[model samples]
Target: MSSLSILLVEDDTIEVMKLNRTISKLNLNHTVIEMKNGELALEYLNGDHKLPDIILLDLNMPKLNGIDFLSILKEDNELKHIPTIILTTSCNQKDLQECYNLGVTGYILKPLRYEEYVTKIEKIVAYWSINELIQKK
Candidate 1:
């Protein structure tokens, strides 16, 4: 499979480290672009940087949460088509409904165990890596 550029919008420092380790463990040849919040993510998306193949977003953040980002992204003509998947711990029905309303591609609940998290991330990476994606660049 071709290498993919992935955008990750998250706020937790430890989660970032864990995710990095998991990605390395999975041995997928993909580049991850990190942003601390949705506002920063939007800035990155609007900049000259290459568009990512997919986005892995967290729901709860300090500024510009995932739902807000999804609302903005899904309305944009240029960026709306990128597949966005939510990776979060929240199991609230409201969150799920809102994300679906905003057009997220998929929603994954973060597992408690490290092994489970790695396995979930592995599946996510593998799927997105092999799945045919629409290129905007």
Candidate 2:
């Protein structure tokens, strides 16, 4: 299988580091395209580039938050079909409901333990890697 290209929209430096380490351990050779916030991510997406197979989004971000980002993404005809997963520390039911309503493919909480977090990420990547995704023209 070809390595999955991932777009990760996150602001926390430590979280990004941990995610990179976890992905490296999985040995999938996946390419991670990092963006500091939703606005920056949008810039990358709008530019002439290949769209990522999936998006890992964080709810808490400066400039444009995850909810707002999702809203914008879902509205765009060309970009709406890509699967977006929420990886956040937020346990709020409202946030969860909102994300689900906005069309998030999966919602995963950031566990307190590093091992647990890694495991969650591993499962997510594994599932997405094997599943067939619809390619938009």
Candidate 3:
């Protein structure tokens, strides 16, 4: 699979470190751009920087939560095509349904175990890296 440019919007420092460690351990050369909150992520996205291939979003945050961020993202014509996956701990059915309704590509519950998290991340990276994504001009 080709290396991917991943936009990870997460609030927890530990989770960020865990993801980076997992990626390094797997020896995947994907470029990760980290944002601590949805507001910061939006600011980055709106800037002149190149867009990421996929977005890994966490649901609960202090400012502009994932659902709100997703809502804003999907409404934008230039930014809507990027596949967004919810990498969250919430198992709320309403949250799941809402995300899908707003056109989220996937919803994955964060596992407690490190091994399980690694496995899930591996699969996620493998799948998205192989898929032909929409090329936003």
Give each model's whole-structure lDDT. 0.91, 0.91, 0.95
Candidate 2: segments with Cα more than 4 A from true spot: 134-137
- For 1-137, candidate 2 gives per-residue lDDT tens digits of 55688999999999999999999987878889999999999999999999999999999999999999999999888898888999999999999999999888989999999999989998888877777783322
Residue 132 lDDT in candidate 3? 70
**Model 3: colliding residue pairs:** none
Return whichever of 2 and 3 wins on TM-score.
3
Model 3 lDDT per residue over 46-124, tens place: 9999999999999999889999999999999999999999999999999999999999999999999999999999999
Best by lDDT: 3
Q: Candidate 3: where are CA atoms >4 Å away?
A: 134-137
| Better-scoring candidate (TM-score), 1 or 3 | 3
Report residue 92 deviation for candidate 2 (angstroms).
0.3
Residue pairs of candidate 2 with colliding backbone atoms: none
* Residue 13 displacement (Å), model 3: 0.1
lDDT tens digits, residue span 50-113, model 1: 8899999999998799999999999999899899999999999999999999899999999999
TM-score of each: 0.95, 0.95, 0.97
